[model samples]
Structures are given as C-alpha cells and as structure tokens.
Target: MSQLLEPFREAYRNMELLPLLTETALKKFWVEYGTETIEELEQLVEDSPSGDSKIIFAGHRGCGKSTLLAQFGRRMADKYFVVFFSISDSIEMSDVNHINILFAIAVRLMEEAEKQKIKIKPSIKEQFYKWFAKHTRTEIEESQAGVGVGFDLFKIISGKLKADATIRDEIKQEFNRKISDLIARINEIAAVVQGASQKEILVIIDDLDKIDLGVVRQVFEENVKSLFQPNIRVIFTVPISALREVRMAGTLTTETNNQIVIMPVSKLFKQGERYINNSEPISEAIAMLTDVMYKRISRDLIEPEVVKKIIIYSGGVLRELVRITNQCCRICLRLIRRKPDDLDIKINAEVLQEAITNISIDFDTRIGNADYELLQQTYQFFTPNDPKEQRFLDLLHGLYVLEYRNAKLWYDVHPIVTEILQRKGKL
Candidate 1:
C-alpha cells in the first residue's frame, strides 16, 4: 500500500491525514491509544449510582476523544439506547446555546428511536412529530403518519435543522425565553422512548468543544443545570483548556459531584524529564503511538526513528502526528511529480525536517511575546506560573502548551513551539 503508484488512493489517504473531524477513527487507524481512558469512562457511565449521569469529557482537541467515545458508545448499545451525534452537524458553532442543544438532542432522540424501530405508542410518536413540526415550522400531514413516514420526516427535518439557519433561529427563539419547557419536553419524550425501548438513554454529544471558548462558557457555565435537566444520561465534550478556569472547573465538579474525566495527551516523557536526561519515554505510550503510524502508512515510507521524532514534535496529539507525517508524504509526492524516475521516493531526513519547518511556522505565527514568555517559564518549571490566566489558557487551547498526566498533571511547551522558542533565543 505504498500509494505512490495509485494516485487516487494516495489522494484519499492524504485527505484522511488532514486534521479534520471524523467518526471512523477507530474503524480506520485502530490503535490502542486510549483504551484505559475509555474503560474509566465506561465505569463512570455504566456504574453510576444515579442513572442520570451527565459527564463532561474534557481533552485536547485532537487527543482521540471522538474515537474513544465512539467505542464507549458502541459498548453501551447492548443495554442502553445509544444516541451519538456531533452538535456541529445540527447547529452552527457560533449560534449554539443551551436551548438549541437540548432541541437537537430531542430531535436526534426521535430520529435514532425510529431508526432502531423502537416500539413506542403511536400517540407519543405523533406528539414528537407535532412538537418538532411546530418548533421547526414544518408540516406533517395526517395521511403520512406511520413509522416509515415519521422516520422520513425527521430525516428531512434533521437535515434542515443542520443546513438551514431559519429553522435553528426559530427553535432558538421559541424556546429561549423558557428553557425549562424545553427540558420538560425532552424528559417527556425520553421517558416514553426509554419505556418502549426498555433501555436507559445515553446521549453522547461530540464537537461541542470545537466552538469558541466564549460560546462554550455560555452554554456550559450559564446553563449547566438546564443541560442536566433532561433526566437522561449524557456526555458533553469541552476544551481541556476550559477546565483551567477555576470557576468553570469548580462549577462543573460541584454540579456533577464527581471528578471531571479528562482524556490526557499521550505521555511521551516522564514528568520533569526530556530526551536529554537518559530518560526514555514511557515505552507503552510510545509504542501505541508508533503502532498507529504502522497502521496508516508503511514503515518503508518513513524510518522508525523518524516516526518517533514526528511523534515527539506532535506533542502526543494524534491529529498533529498524522498531519506532520502527511506533510512528509505530500513533500515526497511533489518530488516524484517533478522527477518520477528517481528510484528512492521515501521520506528522508530532509523531507522530515521540511515537514517540521512547515508546521512550526503556523505555531510560530500564532504565538506572541506574552505567549512566548509563558512558554519559556512552562518549559523551565513544567508548570505555568498562573495556570488560570487566559493567556496561559490560550496556549493550552492553541496546543502551544500541552498537559500530560502520569503521577500528576504537569505542563510543558509543545515540542514544535519549543523549537521555535529555541530558534528565537527565548529558551
């Protein structure tokens, strides 16, 4: 699978490597990257004393939370009616709020229930059709009123809700003044559906973290109670950096009464040790990351040591790791285009360094003097002086600062950002 001879396959593989949002991560690059984190989440969900567990799954943007959550949701399907969907597919990130979020859940609930062919009373199903039709301003004719019709209606309306701004705004206005009513309706629908399906409802909402932090603060901080009012188990994703805010973290923990579960970035080195101290990275984590590479691209395309170097530069973020390697592939592809007669088309030190230089420029440009100062201190101390400062949090959000979990939570500058600092004489 060298992909060099097959232009179409090479293009498809290149697209896969870009840092895009996808649900088929586990299906494709089936790495044992975060099974421990998934197992922990399973216990948090399945074994909850109160069945209505609302969990906040926080992690770096590209830390494989979606893949882990996909597996978690699949495992839950046997006993619970699993409703896994990305909020980005429903509402525009800028326009998202607590009201529209619950609205999306209710719509998705009915849609999934229909797909699963759950036997709900016709009256309850009609109520759902009418409720969605009323809020979304769509008409559901009485003649078109069976499971097949209801499924088709919701399918069309779901697309409109995602692709149409008018429907989203109408629903927002209809429920914005009295969100409790929205919560009540959701609970009512969930109750009937659960009774019919004979399983508890588990809603796993992804992509909520990709929104701006300000918007996340509004939906999560201002209306956290409303978010949990539906009486169904739910999992909400938030930026790992958002938890750095003491009030936000304190509020979520206080409300949930449990520790917030964070999917950690892959821990490469031990705390307070880098590559220089004769200190090796955790072998298991490194192997997991390397295994991920072997699955995607052949080892012949890149050297083993080169893959490890790319991983270190990736700061253990799966998306970044794939992206840097993808860059090398594109570099080699360009060279072959210029001269396909060359026998050796593999990625070499020159190509790998070029990839590093290309990605570092992006990080180098977004960072500022203040961010650099914070990075330098974080590099030296392995912790930010003011972890709660928005600037520091920005670094965390931007992946300029990476948080690693081993014995404790420790912070360090991202390897790419670190190299930039060294070149700038700041480290």
Candidate 2:
C-alpha cells in the first residue's frame, strides 16, 4: 500500500466498532436519537411504586439497545440498586428458557451483592445451595468424583447451570414444579438487598433480544408471568423481531405500570406524498455518527460525501452505519495496494458503493418477495395500518425496513435494500 494509504489504514484499524460499555466509552461514542424515549422510560420507573415492576424494551439487534440500556442503568444507579447484565454472555441464547433467565439473574445478583459488600443471610445461602444440590445431584456427584478437594459449591452450581443442559433442564423442571418456592426464595434475597442498600433493586437484563424467536416467545409470551413475576424492578431488552410474537401486552402494561419503551431508528426522512430526506435530522445524526469514528480514526481518511453516503445506506441503523464504515475502510485498504498514487487513496464514493453492493447481496438472500412488497409499500404510502401489519414486522426483523419517530412515526426501507431491488428492476 502507498504511504498516504498507510495513515488512513492505521487510523481505521484503531476505530472502536464494538458496542460501548464504559462511562468513558459512552461519552466518546454517544449519538442522540432526539426522542423522549429514554426520559419517558425513566419517568415510568420513577413514578411507579417500589414493588415488583417489569418493563419490556424492544429494538433492532444492533440499533443501540446495549448502549442505551447501559445509559439507562447509569441514570438510575444513583436512585436504584441496579444489577445490569447481558444474558447471552452466560447462557445458550437459542435454547434459553425462563429458567435460564432466572438462574442468570440469580448468579448476577449474587455477584453484585458480593461486590457491594451486602451479605445474604446464612439460612438463605444454605437454602439456595440445598435447592441446587437437590436438583443437580448427578452434576454434584460427577464433580465430586473428579475435582472434589475444597470445591466451592456455589461455583460448581453456577458452572453446571450454564454448561450442563441436563442440569439446566432438571433445574428448570424443578422450578416449574415448585415455582412458588423459587419466587419466595428470590423475594427473600431481594428483600435483603433492598433492605441493606436502602434502595429498590433494579435488575436490567440486557441481550434477551439476541436470542432466537422461539426462545423469545417461550420466555416472554408462554411464560411472561413466570419470567416477570419476581419482586424486583426489571427491565428486559427484547428483540424487535419477536415483538409481535409476544402476547402479553395487556399483562405487561398492568404489571409494570406500563413502562414498555420501544427505541425507534433515527429519523432520516420526512414521509409525505413523496419520501423526502429530512436534511436537518439526517445531517445531525450523520455528524454524530461521524464523530464516533473520528474519535479514533482521522476524518481526513474519509471524504465528507462518502461518510454521508454510508450513513444514508445505513438507513439510521447505528450498528449498520458503523459496520459499513468499517467495511469501507477494509475495501480502501485493498484498493490502495493496487493503486498507483498514494495521495489519491481515500474512502471515496466508489469504495462506499462497492461496500454497500456487497452488503446488498446478503440482504438479497435473506429478504423474500413478501418482505420486499412490504418495504415498498412502507416506502411510498406510510400507511396507517403498516405498523400493525405482520409483514411489516417481518421486514423490520429482516432489517429491510426501518422505523423512525418524529412528530409522528414512519417507516422506510433501508437504502441499500431499496437500491439493490431497483438495480434488479424489482422496485
């Protein structure tokens, strides 16, 4: 690669593309979606009484759920004893059941309790271990025969809970049989934590959205009450794809005092007789996203128009925007190696177009004709019934269609999805 390309490549390599977690990372990587969604969610939680409360927040997988939830956690940390965790990190997401969720939360709660120097009653600890030992007899016996010297029972239990499917199933079945007991034990610990901390326990379980649709439905629909019946303030991050499959709207509304919040895509357009790109919101969003990359990489590596094009192609999906930007950097690296002039090397329009074309190929494979028609209709009419339409949900799940909230809500097809269909003369 030419010398000019070297600096650009180096800068691109240093860019932070992963999800933000730390306070510093969030400060550096933040982008305002310019909606009252976060405040509204906070308000609901703040206004509610200090009893068992659950809020269901759904968004597209990469549409900034983790970062937003983390932010929410920080905002509530001062007032609430927050236990924020990502479930997919520990459990089998595709096969996750309500039992898996409960165990994950229990493990996390135990860890946070230890961190905060809050002690669980010895009787409660013994009760928890007894429950574990009774349900996981085979696992305990196997571990005893293998590595029994000074074995920490809780450690063994936690490992088996995450790794052993049979153990997990047994615990799940036992919990199902004696759910009331399990609920009582959870409440006992929750009471202790709340009493010790002098604040309500706010359990923010993130990444339930990453699980399979079947698992999502099973945990949230078939057993919504079971999953959410715990006596703690809970906020679950659910996937946009599984939103329609969830059948507990009324139940969740009544239970959590109606704190369901949906984080929509950043508004990039104003829908009317003709779909017009709303320059102001679109520019502000693009500029903020551009800053995310520029914080690590030099903006000189990318042309301004190229950045705008990439953001447009992303269709306000923050993850997609960063992903395409990363792809462009890679493509630029390869192209720079073959180019004659080092100074001419830059992430230009052609490089972005090539990157988007590659992404469009994948979209083509995943999106079906019905999804295409739904996206097409969403692009044109912005129909009143569109949000409720099942096909519309399909398109949203596929990321073929994007949702945005302005003075009102609207839907539009991802620009890359639209571009590919137009290229094939299908639009």
Candidate 3:
C-alpha cells in the first residue's frame, strides 16, 4: 500500500487495553496527568517524621491510578524501600479483606527483601519463613530450614496462597479472630526491614478498590485502624465510588490524619459545559488523555474529529480512551483487510461510531431499572449530596457514571450511558 497508510497497519497492530505495568510500556505511554495529587501524597509522607504514614486513596477504574501508582513508586524508590503490588495478583478479589491483604503484604515484603537482597538477619528470615509455613499448613520435616531453602519452600506456599482456596479460607479463619496477632506479625516484619535497610518500609497496595463495595465498607469503615497499626508506611487504594460513600469518607478522614488522595479523571470540558467549544482553550487534562491515544498510534491514522469525539465519550477515563481508540483501530484494520486495494482507508467518523455503538451495546446489557433510575436522577447533577445510594455507587463502579473533580466535585452519566438514558426517555 501507500507509505502514508502503511504506518497505520503497524500502529493499529500495537494497541493494548491493560494498565501500563512494565517499565518499557510506561516509558512509551505514561503522561503527566496527576502531578498535583502525587505531590500532595509525597508531601504527606515526607512531613510525617515519626511512626507509620498510611494514606487511603481512590480513583475511577480506568483513570490511570495503577499507572500513576507505578510512577509514584518509582518516584519514591530512593527514599523508601518500596514494595508495590496489586491485591488481585496474590488473592482472589471476591475473597479479599483486610486480613488477606495484610497476609499478602507480609508475604510480599519478604519476597521483595529476598529479591532485592536487602539484608535481614538469617535468624529473622528463618523465623518469618517458619511462621509462613505454619500459617499455610506446610510442615517442616527438617528441624532447621536454611534461609535459602526456606525461600524456595515459601515460593511454593505463596503459589498456594494465590491459587488454593482452602489455604486462603484457613488463613482468613485463623486470623479473623486474632487480627492483633496478624498485625503484630506485619509490624514485626516492617520494623525488621526498616531497621536493616535504614529506610522506612512503604507498601503501596493497589487494586483493593476493585473488590465489592460491601467489603470495602467493612475494611475501611470498620477495620481501618487495624490496617494502619503496622509500623510501615502504606498506601491503600479504593474505588472512587467507595470513597464517595458518606460513612467511608468520614471514617477515613477522621481516623487518619491525611485526607484521601484522589486521582481524578482528566476533565475534557469545563464542569458546566454541555458541548466542546472549538475556540476554547484546550485544558491540560484533555491534552493528557489525547496524548495517551496518540502515543499508541500515529495521529494521522485517525481523524481529529474521531479523536475529539472519543475523548468526550471516554469521560476522561484513561482506559475508556484507550479501549475505544484501540477498537477503532481494530475495526479500521479489519475493513482494510476486507478491501486490500483501499489504500485510502483510515479510522474515520464511521469507524469511530461503530466502536462507540459496540461499547454502548455492552453497557446496555449491564444497565437495569435501578441503574437507570439512578442514572435519571444524577444524569444532570452528579453531586456528593447522595453519594451513599447503592444504585448510584453501582453505576460508578460499573462506570455507567463518570466522576470528575474541579473547584467543586461533580459527576455525570458516562457519555455513552447518557445517550442510552436519553434514548430511553430517562433523561
């Protein structure tokens, strides 16, 4: 085909929907969208000279929280012995709670120290290893398991912790009643690591937010104090919907000295604007979202009109922006394959609409009477006044609604959801 259009084939082939977890992917696609929030978080830890510093934060699912967190970990690497991990990688999301979370943290801390060769006394390592074996029901035939031998065994136990339901339930059952015992173990490990490394331990627990809201309420609202009792500095993430709940918000701020650090969706339009104004100044947030798209593909492959509409429809959620554009690229490539002679074909308005319609259809299946009723209520004013409503919370969790922050925080139905609601005469 022609040289200009040939690049589209390569760009479209390289799109991805998952979070930027690897070093190389992040370097290529990461943009500076949440500088203020990250700075505020950094300040929170730096200012806390004594004891543990725990910060609970929230963001919408696709708002680049995971990617931003990777950046944060890299930023804080020199000052703290950073151990960052997502909860889902270790435990099942449906079974996640504070107990398992602490369990995972302890496991990860040792794993990290071992991987990084951070010096801990051999006696301490052996003690921690035996404790893990006892809790995981792995018996030691040998009286004394060497540190090297123990790590190899612990890897097996760690695999069971992630995959075997029986072990998870047993650990939860065992620790549920004696939470102090578990926290004591966590604090002990943290203290040992900090003492050995000469830096405070910072554990960034990502994707705890992806669990059910009821469990979130139980974890943060009721048991938050227990989660923070460990000596290490920790960052816990919740879904943006969980943070908006009245009781959850109050408990977090009141119990913890620091306010929740929110990674907000980049706003493509002014809070009050109904439509994108061509002559208006393009906000930095909008540029961040668009740049995320252009970074993955050649800008010439997709029409500017298509990109603009996708941004608005994305509702400033980074995942949506990537997903929609990625799908558009996929559709364009498939069409090009169907008509191999068409060198003029690119991602056009029709391709954009096709991708949009396919996604809207998926949302259509998920929306119900309760969701639609809540959507009708908050379609215009997605205020915090009634943020505790379960239906509204579900909408936020499902991304049927998108939340944004400004001088005042507000919400709106997802652009695709809004169109669906309008067509249903609910808005």
Candidate 4:
C-alpha cells in the first residue's frame, strides 16, 4: 500500500510547491531557452539608431509573450533605454479618450530613466510620476470613491493644462489635440530623457493583448498607430483573437498584418527538441519536455514521465502544460497521506482519468453564464474516445482545455465550467 500510494503522495507534494503556474515560473527554470529571440529583439533595438521603430508580437494567450518580454527587458536593461509597461493595468478606453496611451509610455520612460541613473528635470519628473500614479491607481480609487466619482476632475485637469497661457502657446495648443497631443507629450518626455543620456527609449507594452478585444483594437488603431512619434519605439504583444477580430472587422490591412509578427511557442519547443534528441522521436520530445518542466516546477516530487504526460496533454501549449503539472501535484497531495520521494513515478492512464474527473468537477463550478455555451460546445466536440474529435481536441488543448499525455489527449472541462455543465446535463 505504501508503494502504491507513493506516486500519489509525490504528486501532491509537487502541487503544494506550485500553486500558480505563470510565465514567471517558466523563467525560473529555462533562462537560456529564449536567448535567440532576445538577441533578435536586441538587434532590432540596436539597429534602430534613431530609436523609433514599433514592433508588435502577436500570439495566443499563454504562449509566453510576457516571458519573452521579460527576457528582452533583462537583456536590454544595460544596453539601451528600456521601459516595460502593461497598458491594460494603466489605461482604459474611457481613460484613453481623456489621456492617451502615450502618457503611459511617457510614464514608463520616466521610470526607466530614473532606474538608469539618468537625471530628469525635477518638476517634470514629479508631474509625470504623479500622473502615472493617478492612472495606475485609477481602478482602486474609483472603487473607493463609490457613487460620487465623475470624469469632471480628469477633465478639469486636462482643461487646466490646455488653458495655461504661460505654458508655450504651441505646447498648450498641441496638448488640446486629443491623441496627437499625447504623442507630443511622450515625445517631449523622450526628448528630455534622450538629451540627458543620449540613449533611445524602447517602451515595451507586454500583455496588451490579454485585455478586452475592443480596447486592444482601440489602443493599436486609434492611439498607437495614429499618434506615435518617430523617436519612441513601442513594442507590444497582440493576442491572436484580436488579430482575427481585426481581420473580421476589415480593419487590419495586409500591411498592418505584415507589420505584426506571430511567434508560435510550438516552434520554439520543436527547436529545443532538436537540441536534445536522444534516440526515438517520442523519447526525445518527452525528454526535452521533462527537462523544461522540471526547470519550471523543479524535479522534487514529479517524475519525467509524468511531465511528459502533462506536456502531451498540454498539446504544446506551455501554459497548459505547467498548469496540468501543477494540478497533478495538487491531486497527488490530496490523495496521499505521507511525503513521497520519487519524482519519477508513472502517471498512468488511471491517474490521468482521475485528474480529469476532478478538473471537470472544479471547472463546472467556476464558469459564468456568458462562457457556458462555449464551454459546453468544447466538451461535446472533444471527447477522448472519438478519433474524429482529435483535431477539435488538439485545438482545445491548444486553447488549454484538454491535456496531452503519451501523445494521447485527455479531455477535461475547467472545474468551474464542469460544474455548470453537470447541472445542465451537458457533461
């Protein structure tokens, strides 16, 4: 019984160690994995002597955009001026109509300049920081204000800045011109920083794609593309769904799509596989996955084969793979009574089934009304026993629904969604 319970115990211990599997977790393990992409981005930064090229990286969610951006940030910190900001955190559509995203960019530039020991004008610096603090903490403040909050205060400030006659007529005049004014302000800040340090500023907007689709379009089309200056280079991540939405809306032209680069995480994994091939194709993929997974979550409780199962179940989606590994760890812990040592125990078909069952129960309980229909359709189309459903299951796995193991796929609804479906008799 002790031997039988060992794998379960170990899995449980692994889960205890990893509660949330995010890009940060992956970075802890595979520091060297994204070196090439970082180098390419660095080269892009280096080649732009004038410092004004915008780069958009679009990919599916959980495809490691944030991780790649973090890697780029680390590499460029010493070489060129770099400020990483997420627009989703700092700006909203309503906010955008008031103060453009360029304000966020300006704030990021100021912070990075301060970090690099570049001296900025004290008053200008304080004003930028204050504005940034206001914007960054907007959500919290709105919640605190409760019922009486209005856009009037924000408009008053904008009016004051615009009506200041002593502030150069051109500057004040430019300030009132909507998005263009924001760009001018960002350029002014960039110019000030550049004058002090003689370095070009690269503002990286990571995870912009993770926000609402409409907002994503508004930022890129209305603010970013329309108002950007030549001296401030903006790099941001675009979500694949946003791209599809833009295409469907007939807003994304061929030229715009060409400007946006799609970096598939699967391609990176394939490259890693080549670098670490042993004998068999399946063995090589599994081995590479184990090394990668162990690096992300450590190799204390889970075994290589179990990691392989997680990866196969993940359908090459890095986020899903980490999530499954993390979940399995939790499941094993809940089932076992004692600490287990072996991290190489097999996560057989039976264990996989059990995990999915638990996951389904958890998923159904959490999903909301708006997402119910989609979740139901996904489960009905991706059953494990049907060969005809493989493609749909693979897509679902890519989207992070099913887990891939031993080159075979396992179907499980999200715990919150699963509960809903069960109640509806759709499971």
Top-lDDT structure, candidate number: 1
TM-score per model over all chains: 0.94, 0.85, 0.92, 0.62
Give the winner by TM-score. 1
Model 4: per-residue Cα lDDT over 1-427, one tens digit each: 4453755454444433322224554455553444555666666667765567766676656656676786677667676577776655554423332244455465556555665657666556556545543433322232322222223333333333333333323332445566565666677878888888876667887766655555665656654456345467777676655544434224444423344555554422321232244622355445555666665454545554555556655545556566566666555554553435543344455566576566556554544554455556655654434323433323343353433222443344433344446778765
Model 4 CA lDDT for position 359: 59
Weakest lDDT window of 10 consecutive positions for candidate 3: 274-283
> Comparing 1 and 2 by lDDT, which wins?
1
lDDT of 1 by residue, 1-427 (tens): 3336454235338436433224565566666666778888888887888778889999998888887787788878898999998888887777888888899999999889888888887877887788788878788886655767877888887888888888888788878788888998888888988999999999999988888889878888898888888898999999998898988898899888764789999888876677375667778778888888787777666767788888878888898887788788788877777776764777778889998999998888787888888989999999988999988888898888889887888998888888899999998
lDDT of each: 0.82, 0.71, 0.80, 0.53
Order by TM-score, highest first: 1, 3, 2, 4
Where does the lowest 10-residue lDDT sum fall in candidate 4?
Answer: 142-151
**Worst-scoring 10-residue span by lDDT in model 2:** 142-151
Residue 362 of model 2 has an lDDT of 86
**RMSD, each candidate, Å?**
2.3, 4.2, 2.7, 10.6
Q: How well is each residue in 166-229 modelled by candidate 2, as lDDT tens digits? A: 8778778878887777777677777877887888888988888777666666787778878887
